[model samples]
Target: MSQLNKNNLLPLESPKVLWAVAISFLCIWFYMLGARTLVPTDEGRYAEMAREMLATGDWITLRLNGIKYFEKPPLQNWMNALTFAAFGLGDWQARLWTGLCGLIGVFSVAYTGRRLFGARTGTIAAIVLGSSFYWAGMGHVNSLDMGLSGMLAITMCGLLLGQDESASPAARRNAMLICWAGMALATMSKGLIGFVLPGAVLVIYTLVTRDWRLWARLYFGRGLILFFAITAPWFILIALRNPEHPHFFFIHEHFQRFTSDVHHRSGVWYYFFPFLILGIVPWIGLLVQGMWTGVKEQQKGFKPLLMLLIWAVFFFFFFSISHSKLPGYILPIFPALALMIAVYLESAKPNALKLAAGLLGLLGVVGLFSVNKIAHMGKDAIDIPLYANAAPWIAAASAIALAGALVAWFFAGREKVGKDIAILSLAFGGFLAGQVAFLGHNPFGQYIAGTAHVAAINAELTSPTTPIYAVGRYEQALPFYLQRTVTLVEFPDEMEFGLQQQPELWIPTRAGFVKKWLAHQANHEHAVAIVRTDIFEEFQKQHVPMRVIGQDPRRVIIATPVPSQ
Candidate 1:
């Protein structure tokens, strides 16, 4: 009912309200995180790596499916391993690091916005960051990108806070130190991009804004020492222990992976465009306006808004030029964009708010109408019936989002801007949580993780050390669910380097795998091998002595046939 002034602009102004919101976010994050089974390639691989580290007591060297995996740094794995140690292994524990990082990133953006702009801006920024589709989705999964993006947000926030000339000397010093520590942790989370992207942003910002004096405030000598202290030990230890760790991690993972397309993940220049558009979702209209506003808002001394615009732009273009690209690569830019939009929303006219809400409502309506098509689109890999079962939940969530947007639009039209923003934020957050809890996990569990088949295999295996082979394919979730490493039989897709390091652990060809299967049959050992259904049929036609033990549409687990009595 009250018109928002500078003092009363923030919707949840009381400390109690803030704490309540923070706790609510935490509950949603952890709940959604635990509700989902780990997806393959990223979630399963990372979780398996952490599991291996905890089991083997090897914190430095990371492994996937018992093979040396140096594609990324070990910070995320280390955090996950520590979580597993504290909480015991499960989906929640595996995702704890990313979830925590997401929470921290939200707070960091809020704090940064409050300090630079106003309290209202800060609260809005937190809501936007927390409710964003990509940010929230990635946070619930075990991915390195969320952690890296979170740390980078801290790095950017710290730098922005420290750059303020009016800040006390001690506060500035502490902020710079935070910046350095954030950079270190970020580097540990992913690799060089932690330092590279932020460093590039600072350079470009300085060059464009002509703020050379900001360099003096960086506390370079002490900062560099602190950074090395936090980041160097793991690299040094891993290199000393594994002779090939440094080259593969530093050169192959970082340099070669960036400069060349050795990973075969090449994409066109605009590969990230769709992700950027859809990632922000309901806020897309506001984000575009915010970007324009951010660019136009130049002020005397330090320009925080302009700096954020440059940060987002530099991050976008940096990844755009890279030889390889993934949707998660642009995550770090979302917080910056959120802050900009928050600032815009703070002083925005009610009409503008209404327009944005109406558009969001329309988008939700469109999604609801297209739910069937969206669910059926993945039928090639997923069971259509099982996947389509999530359509109702998705439609319900979309309807809730639409209802909230319409209500917010009403509030905005009635000049209740703060209520409008609050309602809109709550709606989006609910939609995100509902989608994650109801829709995101089950399809992935059915298709990617093969949870039923893995559970069946685990049930069938009498011994923890039962020999299981992955023939012609590697299911990333198998080792994690079974709580044991699978022997690779003619399957070295991404584990070629690890296979090279320990050649004896893998059968090099399909023929070699058949020979091993015959040997197990001759010895009367109860051995199982998971292979594609087509491959299993082919092997069966070859008169391989195996019986189906467990199966899914995509894969089958076959064991050595019991001898005729």
Candidate 2:
């Protein structure tokens, strides 16, 4: 009965209850992995790269739409390509790598939390991470950041577990090696920052905590060998195959992208703060409490909480000062934040927990009322309908959150039931709510994906040999849907580097595209082109003979007449 007096996170104490919750949460988590359309830029781009890899059977030289693409490393692409090999190409297969990474972060943090702190803290940490809005949401999306973050979590957790004095000598060596390997995999996932950022954090940790002895535990000799073993092969192979790759990938992509606004992704210093807040979702109220707990924590031995604090703060400032900033860039700090928050949640006062629950409920209510505003969020008239279509999902997500928060609030102070139920309700609620909102986004995602026109475009094709061209524009998602590469005309966009390497892959001018289209017509060969609406209109005014097979607000699919029979 005394156990009932504990906080709202009761299920953590019971093995049966914890397993039951884990199974249910995982089912929903995996189900949503394949539930949505692959959106542009990230989702479609990565998925198509993997598709091309699988199609072409070239593993080392990564290509996008049949052009050399070297914007990042190949770990995620390799995993995604492997996933496609096993499961076949689809939304879920593309996202499986990221989804697994998210799970890896959750479980690793949980295990680390259990090892460094206690069982309760570890269990709560997993709950906090698995449900956090950014982590949970990004996990389901096919993106590189989650993959990096997940591996980074393993590195951080391994460091924490390996450094603890209680660990046996063999355990310590093994954990440290895991830490090194994690960093290497993370580097392969994104870039050098995987190991660089962790190294910087370790340096700072050593200086701040003055734990000079901690350096000896790094196992650098074995670790460096392991790191290179994981990350070096592809770098060596790709550079050997494409000489231009070394300069562009190493210097231009990493250095120029960080120090200058070359990518046009510059953001103000505080840009990530808002994302961090919203990303934590229902846990927003406890962020301060968690940080405060970390700041005030002081121990004689290895300071795990302090290490976490430094990890989070260093990353926040590092990216804040970078010339390029995206919301996902700050993801590496979340695992540390989860561990800090779990420590706070373990011994939090009932009244404080109640207050946080109340605030979460209020947030849900606010979201419910503001959901209608989604209709106005669209920048274009066509997108307005899609945004409106997603409003109901927002409302449903909000209601679920509100319901969970209320239950949590009620159970916060209940001695008979304990706080376990309360925490579980809110965490599950946040996870489900985020998933619902993501599901709601499919209507707009589909519009952006141009999948609605894939069938129409396919029907116009006389055979698989029908030539397709993208004129004055690129539809990132369409290539994956069509399962074939299109000839690019008068546009390079992100594929400029790839185009530069192989100039024959695309037409450089509209005049050239027009000439090619005419030649195809003269040869009586059926060919399709996805033209920007304005370009299509311009071609129409120029008396270009083509049949409109399919069109959306953004683009028009024009096809040449079939061969004379």
Candidate 3:
């Protein structure tokens, strides 16, 4: 119950109180996690992939829409498949792996901060990380990035713990082993960057700090053995089973993905700068101040702060130079930044907390006013009315966050840092609640996810084996919802390689599809195809025999008429 002084430094809360608070926050985090729906392109795609893996009983080789998918390693998919097995497939189950990894990342940061700094800093670090917009949002979503980020955090923390001179040789060895294992799991989660980023950061840190003695204590011999042991079996098994796995996964997925615009995800060099600034929302100013303070503060043997700075900067530039860019790519750097900010926040003045709170409140007001703009931004993809309908939920969430920030500001003015941190935590919870509300509204998913239409198709099917086709485009969510793979007709977007491997399973063009459809109808076989709305009309003009089964604004599902007896 001790209040913070004017300088805003406060003693650590008792262990019992801290644990209770952590447990309570975690419960709230999990409760709000299930409120959102699984979205397309990533969430639905990954979930369906895991579901397919579970259904096919083939663990070694991964597949998406019944095609070999080698774009990512199988660690996350393995975890998700297991989750689906333990619990029934649903929104929360699909997201469980990412969410769990994020929670682990939070605790790992807390433990590492406590060991390196103090209990107070550790506690603050957890709060900062668990509450950040990027960390919180990505944690609840199904994505490879969060799992990779979380594993890398553990790797970095393990390295820090192991390299401490004060720790016993035995403890350091064990910690280094943990570091190796962390890297192995991280690699399994997201391929090369897991190893590349951590290795690069360590090398740079050692060269700059001139810590030549540090490598001796790293226990490299045993560590490398552990790393290879944990990471090699899957890669070897996958390669042996599928001859093309190594070339595609290691070369095309990693090398080509980075150096060329093969994925067509090109962005300007400063693309991530805005995302990074906005991602840590309401904490940007504090982050800048915290980083500056970290640079100035000197530590004796090894400089954890400098190493963290190197980690953040290196990741930023490393991905910035890549042809492909995404907001989640920079997620791994957040925990380091959170720890840096926690260190500064522990000793910051009350006025600093007040200023941050005020800024957060201002952001809330802006969010309230920007609903229409946000709704219109997605007009090309979704019905604007859907976004308008979802706006109130977002507004309510923003209001709650705004209120919490104001209360935190009041507490800060009273020199009560603990109360201020507590309020800010609630504010972040509100932000996440808003995100869930918006996602749950299913505005975007309604257009992209073929679940409802697939359901309609399923209801009308006379047999489970009825042939289905996707013409000219692939709906990422359709296979998952239908619980069956559809034959491709003239579309090979990301599935080009897979289609090449199984040419017998696809129709090469609209003409080929028409021929196949007539053959199926002549044989009295029921066949259905989902096509773009425009393509459906074109087919209708061509006088192709079709009966519309289901239609959405973006797509239409039609079936071959049953031949009269």
Q: lDDT for each of the candidates? A: 0.82, 0.90, 0.81
Predicted candidate 3 versus true structure: per-residue lDDT over 1-565, tens digit per residue:
4443543454346555566766777886786567666777898779989999999999888888888888899999999999999997888888899999999889888998898889878887888888777888889889899999999999988998898778888988888888888999999999988788899998999898898888887788998899899889999999898998899899999999999999999999999998887677657658788788657867888788888888888998999999999889999999989888888887788777766777777877887797768666545434666677677766776676687677767677554445545445544644555464556376556566766686678865679889889988788777776777888888877878877776777778989999999998888888888998888999989999988888878799998886776
Best by lDDT: 2
lDDT of 1 by residue, 1-565 (tens): 4444445554456566668767776776778877877888788888999999999998888888888888888889889899999999898888899998988898999999898888878888888888877888888778899999999999999999999877899999999999999999999999988888888988988998898988999999999999999988988998888899888888888888889999898899999999987678667667788887767986788888888999999899988988988889999999999999888877777766766677677877886898888578655534666657777767777777777677677677454445645445644634463454355446657566777777667755767667898888998876887788888887798999877888888888889889988998898777888898888999979998888877777788888887889
Q: Which pairs of residues collide in candidate 1?
A: none
Clashing pairs in 3: none
lDDT of 2 by residue, 1-565 (tens): 4553454334678778888989998999899899999999799999999999989999999999999999999999999999999999899999999999999999999999998889999999999999999999999889899999999999999898779888898999999999999999999999999999999999998998888989888899999999999999999999999999999998999999999999999988789999998898778878888878768987888989999999999999999999998889999899999999899988887876677678778878998999878767877777878888888999998999899899888888865255777788779878888899899989889988889999888887778888899999998999998998999999998999989889999999999999999999998888999999999999989999898887878889889966557
Off by over 4 Å in 1: 1-10, 14-20, 372-382, 416-441
| Evaluation by TM-score, superior candidate among 1 and 2 | 2
Alpha carbon lDDT at 72, candidate 2: 90
Q: Please say which candidate is ahead in lDDT: 2 or 3.
A: 2
Better of 1 and 3 by TM-score: 1
